[model samples]
Target: MNNEQIMNLIQEISEVQAAGNYVSFTCNNFGIEVFVMRGEIKKSKEWDRTFFFRKMFSEKRTEEMYQECLEYLNKMKETV
Candidate 1:
């Protein structure tokens, strides 16, 4: 969506401008981003907050966990 359209879509949710490649928001308690390419939504992902820090935490931040979390979160979105 365009910026105005994007803002309307997120009216019920909180959207913040972060210095990065995607737009951020909250979904299923996981930080989510609206993936875009060439100024258009490509695919959105429900991020496990520490998405890029898995190597440092030694926690269960496996790919499987990420996929599972995304599956659950996407399902939540489909319902909306």
Candidate 2:
């Protein structure tokens, strides 16, 4: 995804979280699952065919999270 697309994804996720719901992002074989409520991340995970990783961000910042998502997406695209 491009910058605009990523930004839009972030916006959507934020909207979902604000509504007390969850959102997942997926492209090809890679996926990111996020659950945030009351400004706390209850669950966050990223996965691909080769690996599955989970993380909890106690001090998660939106910009940092989005940047990490972009990096992972870029890396996945490169490997494809």
Best candidate according to TM-score: 2
lDDT of 1 by residue, 50-76 (tens): 222133333455444445534443443
Clashing pairs in 2: none
For lDDT, the strongest prediction is: 2
Estimate every model's Cα lDDT from 0 to 1.
0.35, 0.44
Candidates in order, TM-scores: namely 0.27, 0.33
Clashes of 2: 0
Q: What is the Cα-based lDDT of residue 3 in candidate 2?
A: 55
Candidate 1 wrongly placed segments (more than 4 Å): 1-53, 57-61
Judge candidate 1 against the unseen true structure and give its global Cα lDDT, from 0 to 1.
0.35
